[model samples]
Target: MQGALRFGARLVAILVLLAVLYSAAALSFALSPVSGRPQQADGEPLVYVCTSLAHADIVMPSRDPLIDWSTHFPAVTPPGLPAGAYLAFGWGDLRFFREVPTWADVRPSIALSALAGVNDTALRVIAINPPANDPDCRALRVDRAGRQALIDYIRATLADETQSRPVEQAHLEAYYLARGRYSPLRTCNQWVADALAAAGLPHALFAPFSFSITWPLEKPPLLPGKS
Candidate 1:
């Protein structure tokens, strides 16, 4: 009986060894770069550049609605523009509020913002291509020229003294607008893309599925839907 017990113990040890080997193999396969593609997260269908005004406080609605439009109108309207123009121009505030914080956090908002101010939908359509799962997908970075232009535009817009009771107030207004429009989902790489586009630099958006990955992965395929 002792001998039989020893044999049973040996059998159990072998099974355990085999199981360990199998588990190790499975783990290696899963982690291997060539094994499968990385899974794609749900993301926007396209990439876009955000407008400068979208980030300003003047454009964004205040927490207190009563104090917003009526109280802020004198401060919000640009000099030399009619009240109707302010209303129309202020629509950008909504887009800013809705924007996601970063490209990884919400790609569609980035795409839409990037496409803003462009009248051609076809061009906008071309700017939305970037793989959701690609580590390099967030690499879009803004260029120096674009950055300077944005800064200059902000400076000019805020320079009008009549727009505010004080020059500082105008500055604060611009600051709030920019802050509100700032996208968290936007990556440095994406900013480069946006900045370039903002400066009239040319680029194209590709289909996300076009990216080739060696690993066995799952990316949510794009489907037809309203933007």
Candidate 2:
């Protein structure tokens, strides 16, 4: 019994050390910014980057001169979405999203499967009318070229016929089969960071957490006449 107790204590200490190392690495990489090319050229369009406690999402206008999101995402919009709402895109492990609708529902097996790097992933798209003063939302101005690059990067993640396998979830979100592997290293927030870099937008060198992407962004400006 004494030997078993000693082994358990050792295991706990090892886990604590690993957690500390991971936090240090995450913070270090997040602080290292990857400077992007000048994106404030004339006529640049605005896109929003939003974050929750654990996830980050890129929000784009539903209908833009470059593309109509509805055409690409034909799944029924969540109820209460207006005619021209914005679309927020996110990526995560398929089982994690389907089984764990809320953090309260997170299971050890599901979490382990996601971190194990052997699970399928999915893309989450939600229609929302984002508020101007939300601290979690920030606006980024990207030129037409940059916007196109971002679009291409997102499209590349869609699995074949992803639309047919849509999994509607609460919070007015839909999940589509996505092409990618989720692991401890490649988290959803990191996916957002990668997408920003793919579009030549300023991004974190490495983002394993939501704050890594959201911390550097500026809050969106208010619309005309609205305080």
Candidate 3:
């Protein structure tokens, strides 16, 4: 009986040691931070990793259709305005379209939609995009020449600005409405590629689906490529 008791105790001790080692390793991994670009699944590049809140904030702006509502909706006058008058008068004074649209605009809606459907307790929405290797393909890298052109356009549009506030309000309303919806994380690769094409930059928007593993325990073959 004493021998059996000793054996049981030894087994317990071994189990305890294993548990401790496993716990230590797990803690180390959890505490460590990942660096550099996320690995591509098929061909898509991962650009940003952030919480749903952060993602939401970035995407709301891009989905906004920069339209001059006063010009577009000349027939529909603002409420409480006279027949000959307009709503949001003098709105064109402020500069609009200072920055180009990006994927950040639609991230919030995406997060909200995903959270609504899935169990967000253990899972996270991972967004992937194409690599921003070329200067013309990056919003941040809107070159001096491009910046000048954009500014010139804005100045020209706003120069004879008659209905500034109404147009601005329309944009603001659109932004708020989009914010209320599920704005998915935009693949900046596509946005940049589009911008490049519009600007006559030599680059193509490649829409390839891919996956990545943010955790170390995740084995290889992280994500399958989808073209």
Candidate 4:
């Protein structure tokens, strides 16, 4: 019994050490210079990166002159959306997303399953207004070509471009089946970074955490009367 207890303690210590090392590596990468140069994306044709500390979402205009997002996301019109609402796209583990809306809801088994890349993934789309002055949002300039590349990258991650069923949920959000698997290496934040890199926009070398991707952008302060 004593030997078993010692073995368990050692295992716990090893896990803790691993977690610390991972965090340090992530921080180092986040502080390092980004990998790519900014495309010819000047002040116009802006896109936003919204972060919830733990996750990241790519926010784009619902409709533009070159692309009609509604046609691609047919069943994604949530209520109270204005005429020209924006859409926030997030890719994550299906079960983790559906079950754990917040960190408090995370369970060890579910987290392990997601990290193991054993379960499928989904894309969560939220129709929102322009996140102006919101601290969680940071804008990025993308020219027409860069915008098209970003859109193409996002579309390729969809399980079906023609038809998709929205996951039944109470929030004004739609979740669709996604093409990629969710693992420790390809986290949701990493997906956002990859999308940016695909468009030749500024992005991190390794973005396993939200800050790793958002590190280069400026974060506005929280609005008055808001958290």
Among all candidates shown, the one with the greatest lDDT? 4
Give TM-scores for every candidate, taking all chains together and pairing residue i with residue i.
Answer: 0.19, 0.85, 0.20, 0.87
lDDT of 1 by residue, 20-137 (tens): 8754543443334232112122331222232231221111122122222323334444454333221211112223223444444556654556445321111000111123344432
lDDT, model 2, position 29: 66
lDDT (Cα, tens digit) per residue for candidate 3, span 111-210: 4444353311110111122223422122222333433332233223332334333222332231100111111222222222223233222332331111
CA displacement after TM-score superposition, residue 213 of candidate 4 (Å)? 1.4
Clashing pairs in 2: none
Which candidate should be chosen as best, given TM-score against the real structure? 4
Rank order (by lDDT, best first): 4, 2, 1, 3
Model 3 lDDT, full chain set: 0.27
| Candidate 3: residue 148 lDDT (0-100) | 36
Clashes of each: 40, 0, 21, 0
Question: lDDT values of the candidates?
Answer: 0.30, 0.79, 0.27, 0.80
Better of 1 and 3 by TM-score: 3
CA lDDT of 156 in candidate 3? 36
Per-model root-mean-square deviation over C-alphas: 20.5, 5.2, 18.6, 6.1
lDDT of 4 by residue, 31-104 (tens): 76354544465456569999987899999988866687877776666444576778899999999998897889
